[model samples]
Target: MSAQEEIDLEFLEVEDLLLRTVPGLAEQWRGATPDEVEQLERIAGRPLPRFYRWFLSRMGQSMGPLAYPSQDFSARRVLDCYARKIVAPNPRFLLIGYESDEMMPLHAFYDLDAPARGDATVTARYARGGDDPIDRFETFHEMLSWSSLFRFQFEQMSQKCEGTLYREDADLLSLLAPVLSSLGFTQPLTTGRYCGLYERADAVMICGGTPRENLENVRTFLLGGSNAGVLRRILGEVAKESSLEVEVNTWTPALR
Candidate 1:
């Protein structure tokens, strides 16, 4: 199949699965509580796909707080860091990027307890059976697991679930709906409210066809050849329009 055709099929299949798994998604969304819809809308930055919205509102796991399928974190620092960080400020979630043709499973975690002194450090682990370790980087970007999980499953279901039985994607939003609804417990105006960036060649391709294409499109625009110029432009726009009046800060305060 042609690349575009492949993308179309994958998108359609995901839509189907979402519908079958989460019933009444479309109808309920029309009447979804304003707060619930707003939260989902913010993560997506637009009206979501009906099936996607359905999954969040209905099917899949039960909704409540940040609690989900908990795994013993005694041996998993990455997960430990993620759970610890999953609270207020949304924590930092990582994304893996690569060339479009490269298909590798990538996982990222924050090591909050590690010896590193730079706030938080991210560690990316990828299967190294191929030519390169999956592209890696560390940065403090605020994010939530539900959104991160959504991205992971979206990409996985789109590309790798071709032969799988139940599709690697699950309605994870349901798992965290409870934690999300009680936002009063957490402070809202903190720098921790950002999501990390992810990039890959296949992502470049996928972004070209979907509503969120711009999320990565911005990354490509800034990371491509003339990155500095793009950065300045973005900063300029933020400076012009943002309410916080952001200023650049450095690590020099500690050196003095």
Candidate 2:
């Protein structure tokens, strides 16, 4: 099989595993037809990488939190969104998935001059100016796999932390809100008990009081729960995004 065909088969296998292992995790979504895929190429004026085309053929329009856009928004629309300055405003990159509130969108730019082993640079555009380098991958399959794993991890986190709270100092919570939101956290919500919850997908961070108090709350959650790995991964991501210098040992026993 060609490399693209092999990757497509691998994705199908992973999807099958997720469906069987995770209850209520995989929902059926309509995929695009072969003609539609061809149409998208015509619109873009260039051939899409084989793996991405395969994704469109298999998944059609992904729903819920898959982060892939639906077919109702055509590739032409995506290109126009960038060309007309409605989104990324960069004509060189093709817009894939756009989450406006987070100011981040998935983009792919193929080096047309390069050899056609389907080489492409896929990156997340995290800012409005479209100038900064964000998370990047060498291939479309790698990007899709990473996104799928993150969605699975977030689902696990939601199941574990449902109705749970991580109370921190109110002042500290306020200080962290904007930073977290910029890193794709949902807008903070008042729990009406003098605390607020900031969430993204299944990952949540509760804020209330002092740093020490908050640290303890995080520690208790991690040590007392089976979802510590997911939470720790999230914390690492948050710390990286916020550029905060956090000691590893301060958060979880595993690091200690």
Q: Of the candidates shown, which would achieve the greatest TM-score relative to the real structure?
A: 2
Clashes within 3 Å, all models in order = 12, 8
lDDT (Cα, tens digit) per residue for candidate 1, span 1-256: 8643443453453334333333353343222343544453443344433323333333222322221233211112222333364322122322111112235334443333221212233344442222422222222222222223233333333222111001123222222222222321221212211122222322211101111122221211111112234323433443344321323332111213
Per-residue alpha-carbon lDDT of candidate 2 for residues 1-256, written as tens digits (9 for 90 to 100): 8865776664564455335433454565445666666655664567776656756755555533454452223344454565576654334455555443433343444332221234355555542544744434444444444344435543344334322223344233344456667756663222222233455654655432111122433321111124567665655664565444333333333332
The lDDT per prediction is 0.28, 0.45
Candidate 1 structure lDDT: 0.28
User: Roughly what TM-score does model 2 have, to 2 decimal places?
Assistant: 0.45
Candidate 1 residue 60 Cα shift, in angstroms, is: 18
Relative to the unseen true structure, what is the C-alpha lDDT of residue 35 in candidate 2, on a scale of 0 to 100? 69
Which residue ranges in model 2 land beyond 4 Å of their true spot? 1-7, 10-26, 68-92, 102-119, 126-135, 154-256
Native-to-model Cα distance after best TM-score fit, residue 48 in candidate 1, in Å = 36
The TM-scores, one per candidate, come to 0.21, 0.45
Quick one: how many clashes does candidate 1 have?
A: 12
Error of 2 at 55 (Å): 1.0
